[model samples]
Target: MKTLYLVRHAKSSWKFDVIDHERPLNERGLEDGPKMAAHIAAIMPKPDLLMSSDALRAKTTAVFFAKAFTIPDTEIKLNHKMYDFEGRDLVEVIKSVGDEVDTLMVFGHNNAMTNFVNSYGDLRVDNVATAAFTAITFEIHSWQDLIPGKTIYHKAPKEL
Candidate 1:
């Protein structure tokens, strides 16, 4: 069995003069990131792989969860492909995960995160809000199969 946790990057500061990929998190995002991360860490097992988009906002969000999991900086993976918003790159990245990883955590943007959860998990979520987390447990042993799995949890910062 495999468990996947998909986390959307927190709210970003649009006030920045930089490009979209360089936008940093806002105050609320910074607050929510650690809260949500600690919440998940308390309830779930540590992830075998912690991956995030290389974009500034997404990577910052992942750092919070990584710290909660006590994952070293060297163990965290930053992938530029995960910066995709369409979910296609998300699918490609997820499918390419090694079989040795039984549990995986990924931080990225939406509608990719939202689309992925709706299509690959049993639950139908209208929107996966910022700093949201959704976990799906699949019966398949291979990541390449890409079938619908049981949606175990969907958490939002507001609900915490």
Candidate 2:
């Protein structure tokens, strides 16, 4: 079984009126990042690999989660494709992940994240709020085998 933890990046700050990609996490995001990380650490198995969007907010979110989980030597890979990627792009990225890591975590933005969940999850969730988490379990041997309706857990941090 392969487990995928889809984590939307924490809330971003609008302090700077700049490009959306340049925005950083807000105070809520800072607090929520660690809180959400602890929640994930309590139940989910340690992820062998973590892939995060290159965007500032997304990378920061990944760093916080990785530190909270104490995943030593686990680096946050910067994937530009994750930024504003559609469902197909996200799927392709997952499929390209090295087989050495069975359990994985992906930190990215919404629209695509929401699309991915709706396309792949078995349960019905309205929206994956900022810093929210959704865990999906699949019976497939590889990431490519993961398809719609394979999710086992669709939970948000608020629900925890």
Candidate 2 colliding pairs: none
lDDT of 2 by residue, 11-38 (tens): 9999899898889999989988888988
**Distance from true position, residue 66, model 2, in Å?**
0.2
Using all chains and alpha carbons, the TM-scores for the candidates as numbered come to 0.98, 0.91
Q: What is the alpha-carbon lDDT for the whole of candidate 1? A: 0.94
Tell me, by TM-score, which candidate is best: 1
Alpha-carbon shift of residue 3 in model 2 (angstroms): 0.9
Off by over 4 Å in 2: 72-74
> lDDT values of the candidates?
0.94, 0.82
Check candidate 1 and list the clashing pairs.
none
Cα distance off (Å), candidate 1, residue 157: 0.4
Q: On a 0 to 1 TM-score scale, where does candidate 1 land against the true structure?
A: 0.98
Residues 12-43, candidate 1: write the lDDT tens digits: 99997999999999999999999999999999
